[model samples]
Target chain A: MFAAAALALLVALILLVVRALKGPTVFDRLVAANSIGTEAILLLAVVGFLTGRPEFLDIGITYALLNLIGTLAVLKYFRFGDLSQSGGEEPEN
Target chain B: MEAVINMVLLTLLVVVTLGVVRLRNLFAVVILGSIYSFLMASVFIVLDAVDVAMTEASVGAGISTVLMLTVLSMTRVEEAKPAHSPLLPLFVASATAAILIYGTWDLPGFGLAQTPVNTHVGAAYLERSIADTGVPNVVTSVLASYRGFDTLGETAVVFTAGIGVLLLLRRGRSRARLKKRQEERT
Candidate 1:
């Protein structure tokens, strides 16, 4: 069952990769990259279950956190040109 | 089943690599690179290298994607076209790849117990790591205790990289602040 899930995840990953590679806009690629991160976290958890080692889920959690931070950081940097800058008062594009 | 998974993943990785190479948009390249790292992490998990998979997931998928995007924002999104023919680089890369493939011919089959890697200090580490460190995860024990210096060095390298990025990016802000203070004094 876990193997089946992993296989499905891999298929989804491949589709994401294709979208990332064929992007006509930066936003498309960014969305694809974020989805890829989400799929990777799922893959990690499913594989851990298959291996009977739940410790791998800890790594999955870490990846999930990092993925969120990374995506936000990239988007922030793109908008503000610096990560330290706050977006609160800035006019939206 | 494991072999099937490895094969499919490896094929997909190759496809992604080719896409990255063919793409000229920096944003797309960064996205593809992140996908590649995620695939690699999954491969490491399938190979039972959980520690390696974790590191790859953190550094490769997370940090590298952010770093590449940062660089992309700082520079032109479209890659500059080369004036020269690509033949030379293509030849060089192919030669290097061929040599690497040839070198791997001597490697023992995957997970073979009698392989040199599995037979040497690996045995001792597996046998003693739990008893010495009281850690169930042998990889953690080996990294934290047996290879303490190496891990420390890696941490130092990461720290230095963070500091370098901060310094490089923060200089403009500092300069702007100094100019503002100078204008106020004038």
Candidate 2:
């Protein structure tokens, strides 16, 4: 049962990869990338269960944190050319 | 089942690599690269290297993506067209890959317990790690206790690298404001 679920996740991952590759806009790619991160976390959990090592979920949690930070950083960079810049500050010259 | 997952993840990695190579838009390439890293981490998990998967997921998929995007924002979003023909590089890459594959032909079959690696310190560690470190997880014990100093050195190296990146990338608010005022006055 776990293996079947893993296979389904892989199928979803392939589709996500396609969208990331072929997306017309950068935002499209960003959405795809975010969904891919979610898929990866799920894949880690499912694979861990399949391997009978549920302890691997710790890594999944870490991945989740990193994914959230990474996405936010990217979005911030898109909004402000510099990551250090707060949006309330005057715009870049 | 494990092998099947590994193969599929590897295929996804290859497809993502092709996308990275084909795309001229730097932003899209960065996104594809993150996907590639996630696929690689999944592959590592399927191979039962959970520790490696974690590092790859955090560093490869997470930190590297932000770093590369920072670099992208600092430079052109679109890649410049190559000035030279790709033939030479292609030939070199193909030859290197062929040689590496040929070299691997001599490797022992996968998961053979009698392999030298399996019979070496790995076996000893497997046998003695728990007793030596009182840790249930062999990888954790090996990284944290058995090879504690080495891990410490690695941590120091990562720390120093982080410091270097921050020093390079950080722009002081005061400095920026000063520069802006100077520009305004001129």
Q: Write the per-residue lDDT of candidate 2 for residues A1-93, one digit (tens) a residue.
A: 999998899889888888898899888888888888889889889988998888878777888897888889888888876665656876664
Which tens-of-lDDT digit does each residue in A48-89 have in candidate 1?
A: 787787676877777788778878977887787655444573
List the TM values for chain B, per candidate.
Answer: 0.84, 0.91
**Cα lDDT, model 2, residue B128:** 93
* Candidate 2 local Cα displacement, residue B73, angstroms: 2.2
lDDT of 2 by residue, B1-186 (tens): 788888888888888888888899987888888888888888888888988988898899888998898787779988999999999999999999999999999999999999998987998899998889899899999999988999999999999998987766655545777788999999
TM-score of every prediction relative to native = 0.88, 0.93
Model 1 chain A: which ten-residue window has the lowest total lDDT?
A84-93
Label model 2 with its docking quality class.
medium
What's model 1's lDDT at B40?
89
Question: Where in model 1 is the C-alpha error above 4 Å?
Answer: A82-93, B177-186
